[model samples]
Target: MTRTPAEPHSVPAELGPYLREVVHRARAVCGTHLVSVAAVGSVALGDYRHGRSDTDVTVVVDQPLPGRTLSDLAAVLTHPGLPCPATGLELVVYDAGFAARPSGEAGYLLDLNTGPLLPGKVSFDPAESPAFWYVIDRSVAHRCGLPLYGRPPRDVIAEPGRADLLTALRASVREHGLAEGHLGDNRVLNGCRSVLFCRTGHWQAKRRAARAVAASEERFRPLIAAALRSYERPRSAATELPATDVRTFLAWVAERVGEAAGR
Candidate 1:
């Protein structure tokens, strides 16, 4: 048996070219050290919305690369010459050994967040970072990832543990200032998704999951409606939601998710 090359068409057209460029650049830089590349988040879940999503790619390496190789890969992957399809790109690199482990803290070889919110920066040795959110990321990738190269996602990534997911959810809400969380589309939708994951042990796309939570729980309707509208028209000033309502909604979600975790 032989491994197949990545199918460029696996990603949406908006992200296809950029992703192809990334794969080529990574292969050029990492060579045999690079194990696999997979697409996670909305891109893999088949609910990606153009102009409102980030292209998320995870590349696995056989082992920790030499600093020079890691730096080279970062330079090519985060180069400004390659424009992302949407807000930005989130490209993470992981070690194949750690990724294959059944359970433990996952180490990232490199993590890059390039988008409107922050300047394009690449980091090395992210094992000590408190904001390691790979628990949910691994879960999503294991269940719904779109492979670009090497083995399937389930072959490389382990299912995230429940305790880890709850901790990540708490950290997310806490960073959002609990009751005073921002009312941006991502913020609201993520809050809804966290709540849903806690309750059902399943992951869902932002808008659909938000709608589901809203439908099941009447109290979340107004906030979820505002979030859906914002998602539809992200740049429209006309869609700004009331801050007070957003605060209350965040508080409600935080409380509910906390309760769910306790169960």
Candidate 2:
């Protein structure tokens, strides 16, 4: 079930004063014309696990900052309430006017123009960054966003050397071969996109499978065990090869979209 947003949309005791300090730093770095800043990831989702979570927030300015705004805010960032050496989950800044402008369709999953960071723009950047995939592979619904109104964001338009990415996702599938682990990873990635892009109901079945992957390390453990079994047959605890099953597993993932598309 979806949880209610914190009572005040603005910062409150819930985030503690320390995090607010980060917001202030973000505001100064972003300047006064910015639109909104709010917690986004595990912390915002209320799914954060102490020590396991990093702060995720978005700072929307009146216009886009030069680049890597994090570098500027980094100096002023600190907090006893959250943790030290905070990392990942950026404090992105963008101008409201630009955010509202429409970015032509492309490969990116979230609409940059209207992304959580900008709030009203549309972008088509390929969204191919490794760190971007990392978050999608880990959390889906938690991060997938929908505008309260207006059309949903589109995926980055870059066709990322489709043959290359597919070859890689497939090679990894064939070699290491863990149905559940990779499936879960794919699920999270696709699920986040599906939800962010407003395709949830249409892709619900796949999302369900992705959720299972999130919980099944043992099923996936077999892949690593298979590698071990190769060298230490006698000592190997693995029962059989996942080669055949991995193919089928991948097929299931691929049926949806992107690299996993078994086709």
Best by lDDT: 1
TM-score of 2: 0.43
Per-model C-alpha RMSD:
2.4, 11.4
Lowest-lDDT window of 10 residues in candidate 1? 176-185
Q: Write the per-residue lDDT of candidate 2 for residues 149-238, one digit (tens) a residue.
A: 112211211122323444434433333234543333332333332322232322233333344443443554444334333323221232
Once fitted onto the true fold, the runs of candidate 2 whose alpha carbons sit more than 4 angstroms away are 1-15, 66-71, 78-89, 102-251, 258-263
- Which residue pairs in model 1 clash with each other? none
Task: In angstroms, give how far residue 72 of model 2 lies from its true place.
Answer: 2.8
lDDT of 2 at 17: 52
Could you give candidate 1's per-residue lDDT for residues 64-172 as a string of tens digits?
A: 8988888877777664656666777888888888888644355688888786633576789665555426766887888888988778888888776777777777877
TM-score of 1: 0.90
Model 1, position 189, has a per-residue lDDT of 84
Q: Which residue segments of model 1 deviate by more than 4 Å?
A: 5-9, 102-106, 115-118, 178-183, 235-238
lDDT of each: 0.76, 0.36
